[model samples]
Target: MAAGMLAGQVALVTGTGGGLGQAIALALANAGARAAITEMPDRLPLAEQTAAQMRAAGGEALALPLDVTDLTTIQAAVDGAAEAFGGRIDVLVNNAGINVRQPAFDVTEDAWDSVLAVNLKGLFFTAQRVGRRMRDQRPAGGCIINVASIMGLIGYRDRAAYCASKGGVVNLSRALAFEWAAHDIRVNALCPTFVRTPLTAPLLDDPVAGGDILRRTPLGRLATPEDVAAAALYLASPGARMVTGQALTVDGGWLAV
Candidate 1:
C-alpha cells in the first residue's frame, strides 16, 4: 500500500489506550490521518502516550478522555475530534469493548449488562454521534469500522454475551450502511480471531485453553494487533470505497472450518 493514503483525513478511535485500538490509531496516523486517540478518563494518560508516539513518528495526534458507556463523553469526544480536525471526521473506529467470560448457566445479570453496555450499546451511541457529524460535514460522508470478533460469526464457550454483542454489531453495520448509503457513509465490521493482547494474555497463556484455540485455528497462531490494523486501514482507505456493510474477518482461517 502507498504511504499517506489517508492524507489530511481525520480519525477518532475509541479505547485506544493500548492493544488493538492503539495499533489502529497508529496505523491511521502513519497513513497521514490526524488521529484522535480516546480512552477512559483514568486511561487518558496511556492514550497520551500513544499520541506522543504518533508525534515522534511525524504524525498528528491528540488524546481525549472518552468513556463510551457515557453518552456525554461520547458526544464530547466526537465534538472535540471534529473541532480539532477542522470540523471533519473522516473515520470512526468503534474499538472500545469489554468481554465477560462465563457459562450460560452461571452468567449473572450484572455481567451480561456490563458486557453488552460497552460492546453494543456504547458502540451504537458512539457511531450515532459520529454519523451525525459525518452527515453534516462539508463533504458529507465517512467510514465506520466496528471492531467485532470471530465469535460474532461462530459461537464459542464462555462468550455468550460477547457473541451476542458482536452479532449485533455485524447486523448493525449492515443496517447503518444501507441507511447511510445515500449520505455517502460506509459502515463495516472488522472481525478478528483471538488476538495477542494484554487483555487476552491470561487466556492465551493458559496451556489448556491456548492449546485448544491453536488446535482449532487452521493457521495455528493468534492474530497480532498489526494484522487487524491492516484490515482496518483497508476499510478506511479509498481502495474500499465500494465496500460497505461487510464483516471483514482477520481470523487466520479460523472460520473456514
Candidate 2:
C-alpha cells in the first residue's frame, strides 16, 4: 500500500472502468481523496468496482457513468461529483481515450474520426466545462492531468492519427497550463509507452509482434497500470504544486532508448 499524500481533496478520474484508469482512481482514493470514478454505463465496470473497493477501505468514493465524448455527460458527471462531495473539484484526470492502429493509408475515415472524437476533440470541450466550473469556485481552482502516450513524443508506424491526437494533448496541456495559471489551475500531461491493457491485449497475445515490443522497452518489461498510477499520484498531490504543463513519461525508459 502506498502512503497517502492527497490527504484531503476531491478527484475525478475519467475512463475509470478499467486498466490504467482504475489504478489511478484507486490510488487517489487510498490517498484520502474523495474520488469520483467514471465509466460508460454499458460496457466496462471498473468505476463501480474501484469506488466499492475504496469504500471498503474506508475511503470516500463515487462511481458515476460518464462518456467523456459526450459533453452533456461530462457536465453531469462533474456537477454530480461536486454535489455529492462539497461542491468542489480539486483534481481531474483526463484518462479516457480511444486509439485505432492500422497502416496509415488503410485506416478508414470512421476509424480516424472515432479516435480523434474521444481522444482529442472531446477532451477540449470536457476540459472546458470543468475548467469553467473550477474557475468559478471561490478562491480555489483545480488541477487537470491529461493521460497522453509516448506516441505523442515519438512516431510509430500505423499510428499516424494516434500520434497526432496525443501530440495535440501534450501541447494543449502546456498551453492551458500557461493560460490558466491566473485561475490557479495547474495542467499537466502523463505520457506512457504501450502499457499492457485490455485495449492492447489482442495484439500482445500475438506472440510475434508482442516479443518485438518487449525488446524496445529498455526496462525489459512492459508497464502495468499501477506503474502509471504512481506517476499520476505525484502530479496530482500537493508535492507537485509548482509543476504544470509538464509531460511526465511513465514508459520503461522507452524514450531514453
Candidate 3:
C-alpha cells in the first residue's frame, strides 16, 4: 500500500531479458529502487533494453551479463552490481529458470540435468553469493524472493523435470530462510500458476491442454507478468519484513482443489 517504499533500495534481479524477470525488474524500478538487470550473455542486449526502459521511466538501472549456472560469472556480476550501485544490494529476485517438459519415462538425462542446472542449482548458488553479501554488508538485512511455480507445490503432467527442479527451490527457500535468520536475510518464494509467458506458451497453445488448465483453475485465467511482479514487489518491500521461509502462491486458485 505504501508507494515509493523502496526509495533508497537496490535490487538485483536475474534473467531480466524478458517475461516475468523483465516485468519484475520494471516493477522494482517503478517502486523506487535502483535495479541491476542480469541475463545470459546472449541476452545482454535484451537486459539492456529493460534497463533503458527503466531509465526512461525515471529509475536507475544497470544491465549485466550472467550465466546462473556458472559460479564465476555469478560472482563477478554480483560484485559488479554492488560496485555500480553503492556497495549494497538490498533485494535479490532469483527469477532465472528453465523447463523441459517430458513424461518421466520419456525424459532424457540431458534434459533433466539442464533443467535442474538452471532452475535449482543455479538459483541456489546465485542466492548463496548474494546472501553472503547481504549478511556481511547491509546493516539492515535484505530480502530474497525466489520465483518458483505452482508446479513446484503440485505435480503436473509432462513436467517431471520442471516440477522436480521447482520442488527443490520450494524447500531450498525454507532452508535458506532458517539458516539466514540469524543474519537477518529473509528468504521466500513466489509460486505462480500458469502465467502467460514464453515459458508456458507451448502448453498454453495446445487448445485442449490450455482449456483444461483454465477449467481446473478457479479463477479461469492465466496470471500476467504484472501479477507476479506485484507479488515480488510486496515480498521485497518493508511490508513483508516479518514474512520469510514461505511460498506466497500467486495462483488463480489452481491449487485450491
Candidates 1 and 2, the one with greater TM-score: 1
lDDT of each: 0.94, 0.87, 0.93
Model 3, position 127, has a per-residue lDDT of 95
Identify the runs in model 1 with alpha carbons over 4 angstroms from their true place.
Answer: none
Q: After superposition, how far is residue 19 of candidate 2 from its true place, in Å?
A: 0.5
**Predicted candidate 1 versus true structure: per-residue lDDT over 1-257, tens digit per residue:** 57899999999999998999999999999999999989999989999999999999999899999998899999999999999889999999999999888998898999999999999999999999999999998899999999999888989888899999999999999999999999899999999999988778888899999999999888888899999999999999999999999999998788898
Collision count for each candidate, in order:
0, 1, 0
Task: Output the better candidate (1/2) by lDDT.
Answer: 1
- Give TM-scores for every candidate, taking all chains together and pairing residue i with residue i: 0.99, 0.95, 0.98
What CA RMSD would candidate 3 show?
A: 0.8
Question: How well is each residue in 71-92 modelled by candidate 2, as lDDT tens digits?
Answer: 8898899899888988888889
> Compared to the true structure, candidate 1 yields what TM-score?
0.99
How does candidate 3 score on lDDT? 0.93
> In candidate 3, which residue pairs get closer than 3 Å at backbone N, Cα or C atoms, i.e. clash?
none
Among all windows of 10 consecutive residues in model 1, the one with the lowest summed lDDT is 196-205
Sorted by lDDT (best first), the order is 1, 3, 2
State the displacement of the C-alpha of residue 192, model 3, in Å, after optimal TM-score superposition. Answer: 0.5
Model 2 gets an lDDT of: 0.87
